[model samples]
Target: MLAAGGLGTPAQAAPTVTPAAVASHQSPSAPQDLAPTPPMGFNNWNSTHCRAEFNESMVKGVADVFVERGLKDAGYEYVNLDDCWALPQRDENGKLVPDPKRFPNGIKAVADYVHSKGLKFGIYTSAGTKTCSDIGFPGALGHEYSDARQFADWGVDYLKYDNCNNQGVDAKKRYTTMRDALKATGRPMVYSICEWGENKPWTWAGGLGHLWRTTGDISDNWNSMSSIMKANLELAPYAHPGGWNDPDMLEVGNGGMTDTEYRTHFSMWSVMAAPLLIGVDLRTAPESAFDILTNREVIAVDQDPLGKQGEVVSSEGGRWVVSKEMADGSRAVALFNEGSRAQRIETTAKAVGLPQARGYTMRDLWKHSDTNTAGTIAATVPAHGTLLVRVHADRNWAQYPPALDVRAQDTVTQAGHIAPVTSEVTDLGGNAARSVSAVLTGPEGWRITPKSATSVRALQPGGTLATDWHVEVPTGTAAGDHVVQLTAKQRTRSGTWLTSTVPVTVRVGVPLPPGESALSDAEPLGSANGWGPIERDRSVGEAGSGDGRPITIGGDRFAKGLGVHAASSVEYYLGGACTTVTAQVGVDDETVDKGSVTFEIWADGTRAAATGTLTQTDPARAVSADVSGADVVRLVVTDAGDGIDYDHADWADLRVTCG
Candidate 1:
């Protein structure tokens, strides 16, 4: 009944944990077949929490969506519920009670409905005396046996045991009590320990739980998501089959971050082999959200039978390259950019532990295309984006033309304005490509003409071809995100043809007022800060807007400015009417002489002004960039060789003049 295995019991007393003890810990003996892959499901905490909408109908609708929307087939099997599902107090019989108001038909009926849909049902409870919500529902700290038996009777296949109001009890003992209780019921249930990594549960909970939260609760923002990812990325060594290091639930469809940032969130989590728990409401979710959640290729990497967590191959200046070894001898690689602008991150097949071969076949998980490479694996990853690919050595890859790396700049311009979209094509394979040609096309009624040569007779291996296109937006085009396409084609020596298509995103903006104004006074076409909002006339705070003090750099205070963190960008539409942009840029003094950053201003994608490696001790430096005939201007900040820790940067006295 207990899967025909024995689990050792925890010690009666909680032992103090030391770093040496964590390092010397042995592998967990948890059931290997319970979750051979990370569990995929929908957790209704981020989008619903304890709201009235989180009721029986909503829970059943989730099960329906998973079946109708292809999620169930994509390997999402569990429909989980987070806190506040039960009555605030226990019954006189010393048993927990489900909130009758929320579950009018009772939790057992809901579990039966979910099971009828061919999906497993999961429930949540804390290891303490009370749950995490303010309503304070009863927990299973001392009632593990009773609660476990009750859950088994209700047909709960997964149990997410949380840590709240733990009452100073030992973390290991608290979780082990519940694990042993579940075993006693003779019903197999996946155990998730939600201790928030306060006691480093990954060191001890592997054998006690199927997955453990490695960071604090995740919020729906880039700062929160990226920081949690960084924390969990370092604990890959502790994860294996039947156990995993969870960064937190997936926030892919939450409104706090852009779709690009959400993609990064999902990409990094997949590479890390973290659980794919959808944290948004599926009933009213947009198609874009579904597009991201159901990316089967990315999901495949997460569900690889090998169960090897991705490890960082290289990280420098906010650019990270991570690789996961797959069971089929392929490596899933992710090129992630945490910077403000586009950057090229590089790694090699050998670097990812692949055997030497004549060529390697690469499959882009996002683009859904295949390319051949000699060894180099590189991409100019966009800000807050990840390029996910699968690479494996192929002896016959030479029969195909090396995958041409075709890409274009993501342009931001005003309606009726002419913008330049530069593109590049490179042959990354060992074989030469013949009859190489490229073309750029825009939406209907938009004129797209090439300004450079678009064809070549022969392209040697490793050679690059650059092309420029002039994109003229019509006067009445809508002011929203638009798409442009760049297509490249080539032929192998065997007469086989190959084509690569790349999509470039263009954002149309409204022109600013024709006068001198504080840069922060106008809305930016795009803004991406490493942490928190881009503050107006204040230093970059850790959270909400207006939370920062006056913009200060080297003890100098400024009343009119913009505050940002390193790896930040703020872009504004100029309508080709602005003359010059000026600002005093330096590291913010809030960091107490501990942070370093670089500041730059770009006019129409060209660097017009820059500051060299400014530390907190450096005085504010003046920077001015000419914007003659430029349609857009961008203020940028990046980490200075060192990491981005505490890198609060400021653009003091920032002013833009137009007309």
Candidate 2:
């Protein structure tokens, strides 16, 4: 249950049951009754990071703006002071004190000023020995209870706990310690965990805190803000009432972000159900910032009682379509354009599992108007802008049946032709190569080549076979499916041949909207050969002339000149605990490979732990392995290889999963 704060006088604490107690008792198991929606607030981190010159006057100034501009009435209740608020040293009792220069009136005075404006107050601290502000304030450390009491005494309504300078200890324990301590304080304060992806707090922090930072710190620039927003879309499934996945603080209203970017930022956050912690200097924000922040339709999504964050359903170029399930069974859709040019983003109600109902209510979140019709919604979003629309069934609407197309591509080829089998063609494991002969027939002028053919022993009656022939399909092929035929021939007794045929189909790849790549382009860690040169397409590399160390790609190279193979092969490592070896390979620019490519690490050249595969079916992908075990260790990349250019690889992301 949401804990209660403050003490009632003896006269008010009589045996009479209050309305709040009666309502609470009526709902015994509702999660919303316990946690409800997240508290809306404004934080000072993104725009002003511990400006040493800031004082209580500055705090009061920002608070005054919140009140005068109706931000507090709009549900922004907390004025959070982030980092560098404490003195350089704690008192002998291990209690942190506000900095005398910046907070001369003490924390209580600042809290009082905020309270007078009908807003709550928040403070920041670290789970480690030192805060990010570099101040030597006492942390939760071994004094979780003491620190909790101190914060309570200071009337802090919320606490932002940072995870910096605190390592070697289990991260969750550190967070839980503070949570328990705060619970014991008899003072209800919101807990915000600031652990940046170390242990994805979004998956488990719901029981321990009010919110958790899901991404790294956001800057005031559009690139950083948009990138962080894009990453947070994948984490939407975890956001809910009482707990939220924070994408740092808002960069909107900050001077650096463009007006269009600011609108997109606000629209995206609302769709994601992310906390609306405005980080701008409110006292000086332009009118546009206020309009973007206070859009009722957009704010409705963020403040939706259902509290479901939006997820990216489809994205191309700079256009992205995201959807969030609302409490009323309606879906909140956000069409975002992050490109330099305006583009039309469209989505059918069926695509989002919605009823194709005519005359449905489509309220524009930013414009605060209802759209006329809604079977299929399309909007020309401005560059770096967004359109948020809440789709709901109206009594005057007509519903239609849903239509969906489901099909999978069945053919694979290289350089626009059926590649022949060759003696050098091997599986991803570097095992013995496999050889086969195939014949392909299609429209006139179409070309066919063998990729792994061992020998040209026989051919069909009317087919032409060439070892050096490679087909090149023109760019921008028409959208739709096209078919061709492939016939395989095997040499038999008396110079005769056996032939078999298979059908192949090709579909034109869709281009991204403007500034984005398809999902097929995302690369994960620990992929084999993820760090090789762009020209070498082969999976495993050939051992160098000397020393013959196993070729490694992803991890930090210890023995400077060691070379990883171009084909695929497992490598063993031996050395210091800090030393590591990695292997990675890139996929072709087109085509996505399915299934995980697992890497097993062996200590002393023996099995240590069986790690799961780094799975991907995305185009332009890379995976790697990190070897840091003691003595000797072996790293293996599993699964069969696919696609062309496994020979002439490209440079991609190379990072160690674990070290």
Which candidate ranks first by TM-score, i.e. highest?
Answer: 1
Candidate 1 scores a C-alpha RMSD against the true structure in Å of 7.6
lDDT per residue (tens digit) for residues 1-659 in model 2: 00111111001011223445333322111133324666678888777776754668778988998888878778788888887788877888878888888889899999999989888999888888877764455566777899899889888888999887675678989998998898888887888888875577765677688788876677777655775686677666566777787887888887887887888888888888888889888878889899877776678888889888887778975589998889998889888876544456777666765765544556667656443343566655655778788877675432211111111122223233332322111011101111235444555555545443424433322222332223334444343334455444443333454343333443322322222221113221112332232122222232222322222233222222222222223322222232333333332222123233444445543565543433333333233333454433434343323211222222233223222
Q: What would the TM-score be for candidate 1 when compared with the true structure?
A: 0.79
TM-score of 2: 0.58
TM-score of each: 0.79, 0.58
* 1-659 per-residue lDDT for model 1 (tens digits): 00111111111112244567657655666676888999999999999988999988999999999999999999999999889889998999999888899998888999999999999999999999988888788989999999999999999999998888889999999999999999999999999888888788878888788999887688787777887787788777777898898888998887888888988998999999999999999998878899999999999999999999998898886789999999999999999998755666788999988999989999989878777899999877777889999999998777556767777778877789887898888888888778999998889999998999998988889898888889999998876568787888897666877777656777898877788888888778778887668899888876567788888887789998998987788888887889989989888887775778899899876999888899888999999999999878988897775656678889999998889
Q: What's the number of clashes in each of the models? A: 0, 54
**Poorly placed runs, candidate 1 (over 4 Å):** 1-23, 255-260, 407-422, 441-452, 468-485, 491-527, 539-558, 565-659
- Estimate every model's Cα lDDT from 0 to 1: 0.85, 0.58
User: Cα deviation of 334 in candidate 1 (Å)?
Assistant: 1.6
